[model samples]
Target: MSRKLDPRVVRTRQMLRDALVELIHEQGYEKITVQDITSRATLNRATFYLHYRDKLDLLYQSSKEIVKDLTECIDLSFEEDKEFDFLSDKPHIVFIRLFEQVSQNSNLYKVFLTEKNMPHFTSRIKDVLVDFILKGINHVQPDDQLLTVPREIAVRYFAAAFLEVIVWWLEKDMPYAPKYMAGLLMRIAIKGPYVNNPF
Candidate 1:
């Protein structure tokens, strides 16, 4: 069984996370000291240490939380046998929601994604996406250049594509809104036959 977190503990951690997000936007992660975070959070060094091992550890915690929330919003079961278009809509909507949250503090996310810590965040997202795709499309076997790729391969491809798109968006100062991006990315990722299958 899992233990429930204390309300006070949860609140304190969120405060620290909020502070860290704010601080990262103003300066590089390498340049932002622990003292800066503690000061911004209005908490002491001991309190910061109690919640996280260090700055890097806090970043991991933030990434883990985002991934967990994202995975939860996804429904793994599809007993109704959804149409491909139906499947496309789900990702577009879900990703838009995540993107909206990211847009709240774009600069913070920009710093996080481009920094050395990217691999940690990228890997966590890839693992979740892999598990989601592998379970949903377990038997996707194409017979052309769109070959019979394994579920793991599909996940990796999806994750890689999304990461590239996201990095570009961040670098571009996020010229488009989340809804526009959701639609555009859906077009790129909606899987289908290599040959025309407009049935």
Candidate 2:
């Protein structure tokens, strides 16, 4: 039950987001000021203030919108039911959808994932992933059985690894296609690294 926003508000917000992103790239987030964003967006200081309390508020809003869209896309693409099987192709499909979403928003992903200065953005994303991973773990585990390793540890391990790989891919400008990366991720998820096996 969400109310629709005015079209003008939506347009103005998008303009501000685009301006902020452009400014961030040019001078980094720390150096960008409210005046810079307002000028870039063709809006006045009062208008910017009306929509956002400050520059950091604008940044949080932008980051939240991106994360919310990503979460909804992933959840809708990989809905879980009583019959849903985690060990089947569903996880792979989810991973593929994730990579596709990231590829679609490569500019924003590059800025948020690889930018060392944006720790808050990175932490927020990790928090989202950890929640999803915890749900995934429970989905895969039996109701009566307990995991040998703590659930939080396992969730954090996979979440951190996934984020690290994402950062690497973004930093390298996505040398591989999304499909190829998805395949590799699926294989690793199933077989894991063979580090302990004898050569």
Candidate 3:
């Protein structure tokens, strides 16, 4: 009750993702079509639809694939056997790896980081960050009810803040070094909001 795709299937999917990425760089995501992607990728229209529903699906899959790879490469879940301040270091280290990924392939990440019209990535980012926040919170406060309104405010704001900061960093014409920016990001994220809120 299983299936393994042929090697060609793997290569074809990669081709589509790569082609779509190139096309996105040349033109905005809104302007891209399935036909355009397939043509550039040297595959047929049927092949394109068989693999991806549309340009947006291709884009989402590509971003997920890239981030999953980055996540796997980094050891974010180190054991805290000693007082090494890994909590403080976590986001900064992740930021370094994330932005280093961007630096290596800026064009690809630009498409991944902020393609405003695409809602798929919006959900993906929220899901990833929410999970991250829950993990950190559970580790620190295992008995707390995370679903409460007060808790949601902090988790939601924290994730949104991190994403906005990252997007701003990426969109900058002169990119900051990811390691330094990561440290700065982690500091604020761990510290929570600066101004008071009556929530």
Best by TM-score: 2
Q: Using alpha carbons, what is the TM-score of model 3?
A: 0.68
Off by over 4 Å in 2: 76-91, 143-148, 193-199
State every prediction's TM-score relative to the real structure.
0.70, 0.82, 0.68
lDDT by residue (tens digit), candidate 3, 66-157: 66665554435422323436356454344566556656656566666676666666567666766666655555555556434566677788
Error of 1 at 20 (Å): 2.3
The lDDT, on a scale of 0 to 1, for candidate 3 is 0.68
Model 1 global lDDT (CA atoms, 0 to 1): 0.70
lDDT of 1 by residue, 54-155 (tens): 998888898788777767765435444445454454444455665665576576567667777467776776677667555545433323355466555766
CA lDDT, candidate 3, residue 71? 52
Give the clashing pairs for model 3.
none
Residue 14 lDDT (model 2): 88
Deviation from truth (RMSD, Å), model 2 = 3.1
List clashing residue pairs in candidate 2: none
Cα lDDT tens digits for candidate 2, 24-126: 8788999999999999999999999999999999989999999987787667423345565544534456677778888887788888776678888899888
Each model's Cα RMSD: 4.6, 3.1, 5.1
How many times do residue backbones clash in model 2?
0
Clash pairs for candidate 1: none
